[model samples]
Target chain A: MINFEEELKRFFPSLEIEDSEEAIYRQDMTDAADLLLGVIREDYAGYSETPTE
Target chain B: MICFRCGAPLSESDFCNACGVDVRRYKKIVYAANSCYNDGLERACVRDLSGAEHSLKQCLKLNKNHIEARNLLGLVYFETGETAAALTQWVISKNISGTNNLADEYIDRFQSNQSRVETMSTTLKKFNKGLELAQGGSFDLSIIQLRKVLSMNPKYVQAHNLLALLYFERGDFEKARREIDRTLDIDRGNITALRYLNEVNAHLGIPDDKNSKGIRIFDNPSAQVIRSGNETLIQPLNDREPLGLGAFIQIGLGVLIGLAITYFLVVPAKERAAQEAANAELYAYGETIDEKNATISELESRVSALEQNNITLSDSLAQYEGSNGAVDANNYLISAAMAYIDPNQDATQVSEYLELIGDDYVETSSSYEFKELYTYLLNDIGDSVAQNYYDTGLSYFNNGDYTLAISYLSKAYMYNANNDNALYYLAMSYYESGDISTATDKLNTLIESFPTSSLVDKARQRLDEMSY
Candidate 1:
């Protein structure tokens, strides 16, 4: 898997990824996995290749 | 803050206490270096090249990795005219920071031939303007502008050359030579300034050689002078010469002929005529002298007789005056009395005679006689009495003795009713003595009688005040 953060570093050389508001919000969403789990299931139940790992 | 390399917690010290990372110490060094670099950058921004160089040196001393300091230090050196040193510094800075492009830009701009060309073009424009002024006959103004251009770019060879030309045009050969010398000092091979220098030298007749040649004395100086003197010099056509001998002889002969003609033709005729005229004049003079002598004798007799008659008349007049002294005294007394009574009247006949004598006495410095006559006229018995009455009246009136002033003033008024001074004073005396109605009546009569008198205004003012 590509490290999006490092790839973005090449595009925006002056960027500070950990200090970015969008990156922080994404981290918060990942941390609330239980709250996102039902929404994810309802939205992609028919998708066969939704990786479980 | 965490250590980036080791994921260690950064300590206050350079070395992480747990992992010995040396992070804080390195950060401190970087901060110091950056501070000095920033200071150097600020000084460079203000165009303080020397101060910027010093700050940048300090930055480099603090941290050898300060690439910005090295690059800016090069800029400072370039600004201060140290081109080689600037190139060295910039190369080192570029080595340290390959991303820095400032040093490259400066090197490219400064090393180009176009820069010198542009400078030359600006200097040429200044020289052209100076030339224009010089051609316009404003030499002083052109010299001033050319001097400013030379100061801005001293190596402007064309400006120095043209400035020399302007000085030469103004007849200032010394200044022209000095300007050419300046150009030569800058560039020894300056052909234009050199050519102008040679031209000035040729015009001035100064030898192009450095050393002076002494005068040669080959031949005998006295012999050469004698030879040159012996040569019959040809006189120019316009040369002035003395009159020829023939012309002088002719002038002398002409003058002699003129003298001979005047002597033979004019002298005898003029002499005979003068002799006849002299004889006639002598006869006429003799008769005139006789007539003049006769007239003189007659005039002498007449004068002597008139003198005798004058003496007799003078004696008779003296005798008559002596005999009529009392009558003259009486006449003077009456005239003086009349004058005192009517001060406006002309002097009587006796006073007129006295005035004539007074004028004669004044002209002859006979003040004593004039005083005697004046005293007799002024202090005669009748005139003195009248004057005494007038003075007593004036004194009484001035003293505010209204009843007595009225009586004395009335008597003086009878003698001369036109005495406005006495009348006005008398009216005031009456007014002061609480007889307002009497004072008003007196002033009314004075005003009506003496309309042109000086005291009329005072009388009217007094009457108006009393009425109010």
Candidate 2:
């Protein structure tokens, strides 16, 4: 699985992506997971993605 | 002496040493005149108008043939509003230099406004006298004088219009109507008179006929009494059908009887049906609200339980100390809790969850968790609350909406006092809006307070660029 830091670097170009130890340790995996869930919930509510019948 | 052709300083001699020009008798006089001219130019550069005038005058006094000194002295007088002096000096300079261009330009500009100045002064005197007479309650006399002014200057629309208003105030409708008609004749679409004409016709109960160009002068006392009183004078619909008091009483009684039958028979049934429908709607609304409240409470309790489980998993991860799998599991649980406290899903609920999480984090000394929870809490409160203004401002700034960004950023700065991000964005917005001084002050404050921020280098660069 892609790391939270890598996912964030892919989405946000304005954020600086450095390979410092602090960057690796402060990855905030929970925030990443929360953002993913929010996107999924929005897609479901807007009917952009539907469950198979 | 050194020659004027070579631009060399002179000595007390009969000829120029550098350029070989014969400057025998006039060399000393020309040199003194040039020095005075240079001194006047310097004073003019510093905006010392009086000193510049004195120096230029001295230059001309030393050498009456110095045309440049005379021209510059004319400019000084013109700048000081002494138009006559300036014209005289320029005419003399033109004679000395044998050039009509500069003197003619000054004379042309001055002569264009001379007639207009005389007319404006006369009009001002008459307007002031009219005002004094009107203030002393001499309304008819004021109107008469204003009419004379209109006759002299037939296009004086304000005089005709004001005289009409004064006559109207004095209750002389014939005179008022005549003056208003004159005003409208001069300017065909006078909105003021048109509006006053409507009021006059409504008061007199007279239908305005388009073919009548002359003012209607009525001597009928009944029309005058109805015009002056506050009584409603409804015109007769037809000449053959005159209205009587007995017919009015019969019509009023018929309306009263019809209203009584509708109130006694038709309204009770409609009122009963409306009451029943309203009660049924209220019952359904109450049930729905109650169901929603219960569901929300249940969801809240489940979220609290999940949070407790996450806390237990975090404790377990701490006990295991270096177990990667346990830490990953703990991270997933916390992420789920974060998603449950989403801001976009009902902000009030999200705010409640964040408040609870903030309290827990504060008690546990979890500063990292506290910061994340606080940030989310601020965002959930939205721009209506000042704490969320910075986040909203950032969203606007990123969208290139500089005006809205400045509005929200100013509110955020008022709330938090030390929000460097809001201050920086506010300055940028102000700079984009062409407010340079406010932008400079904000940038100065940010540089002083947030030197270690990521935007510090950019702010410093902008400050340097703006300093010049």
Candidate 3:
């Protein structure tokens, strides 16, 4: 059951939405994908157009 | 499937045949792992790289030795701009399954380009810099560096996970959730990701649905691993169902609170705003009315002053009209001028006309020209009129017409107040016509007025007789 006090505390007005930059081509770093992520793929063709480095 | 309790294969039984230990939970774990693997394979076929990565990570969590899952998860990471994470998964998979593994081919491809491998190591060093920044409480700087690292080397799992962790700490839960979701997609069974997600879920008020694998529940903390003569025993605990009515009450109260807040707070605030606006309008109108009244009062004062001025001007205008003082003065002066200029006209007539001009009008005349002209006319007319009136009075006195002589002599004296003859004869006429009182008054006037004249002797003699 939902405790009313705990539930009421959730509405304390501190939660504020923040904005962030969106990158279209984003990769998720899965731990399962990388128990410790390995340098494997070579599809850096699209990202190379705008070199961040 | 092999039993977790016994190093022996089992044949479709809930318990291990060799150890007499229940293996129902373990079998379900294996089944769940297989189910995830199947789900991953379908996602991979459809090129849903993120989903496949997620499903495969779940599969690996249940059975870390799932070679196909580890290999596939790496491949999925590669397609989604995370080359380092993909290669890392493949390398681990190949290490686990040493010979002729499918991960070997992927690893060979990476090893073939030695320069690229060096660059990948450099990316790792940058990742370390981002880590130090985060530890130093420079979360914003760390986030920037980590995003840059991900863009350059998108497969950097640590970068994505750290970035998410920073967001989670900064109260940027949406960003944290996005990062955590991305991390889970690449590594579905990542404990750090799952743990962070549970925290995110707790803040979000959702259950940890991902952690609910087909694992045995251990309720009694004491019984799960009890040491009995250097041997440990494990037991499982079952979960109880929830009571439903309490959930309903909280829902009903939440709705009631939302309604009360709108009615008591928001509605009153709106009404107060409306009333304040009305008061402001009323105040503005009052000011406008005050201004208008001030203007009207000023206009009325001006009009009253103008009306007073008009009345004064009208009275002044009436003074110059027919038979008023100004007109009478001008008429008498004109008649006197005409009579004086005419050689045949009588001097007495001019004197009579000049007399018609009142002393009040002449004294009040502000004009220098009017006063000078009137003075000259009066002097010229007075000499001739006094002589003529004096002779006429002597004629009347000799004829015994005393009343007539008195009137003529009085006129003669008025024209020239210094004429002693006119004064003496006028006094004698009054003495002869009146009683002793008149005789006495005449003698007193003759004696005082003409003390040097011949009339003074007779006047004193008459006065002595009257007194006797």
lDDT of candidate 3 over B136-230, digit per residue (tens): 66878988888887777765555777787778777887687778777666655556666777787677544455433222223444334332321
Task: Give candidate 3's iRMS in Å, 1 decimal.
Answer: 18.8
The C-alpha RMSD in Å for every predicted model, in order, reads: 36.5, 57.8, 19.6
Candidate 3 clashes: the total is 9
Candidate 2 segments exceeding 4 Å error: A1-53, B1-25, B115-468
What is the DockQ for all candidates, taken in turn?
Answer: 0.01, 0.00, 0.03
Residues B1-468, model 1: lDDT tens digits: 444335567766766555453355456655776888898888777655545777788777656546668778877654443344566666555555677467677657755876754554455456557766765668788788789777766755556776787777666776777787776655454556667777765554444442444222223332111112112122234345557997799889999999999999999999999999999999999999999999999999999999999999977665444433434633544565566467575434334444333333333333455456555554343243444446787787777677887766654554455577667766877888888998898899999999999888888999999998
Candidate 1 TM-score, true structure as reference: 0.22
Task: At residue B191, give the lDDT of candidate 1.
Answer: 56
Model 3 chain A poorest 10 in a row by lDDT: A12-21
Ranking by lDDT: 3, 2, 1
TM-score for chain A of every candidate model? 0.27, 0.32, 0.23
Runs with alpha carbons beyond 4 Å of true place in candidate 1:
A1-53, B1-20, B114-468
lDDT (0 to 1) per candidate: 0.61, 0.61, 0.70
Instruction: State in Å the error of residue B22, model 2.
Output: 8.5
Task: Tell me candidate 2's TM-score on chain B.
Answer: 0.22
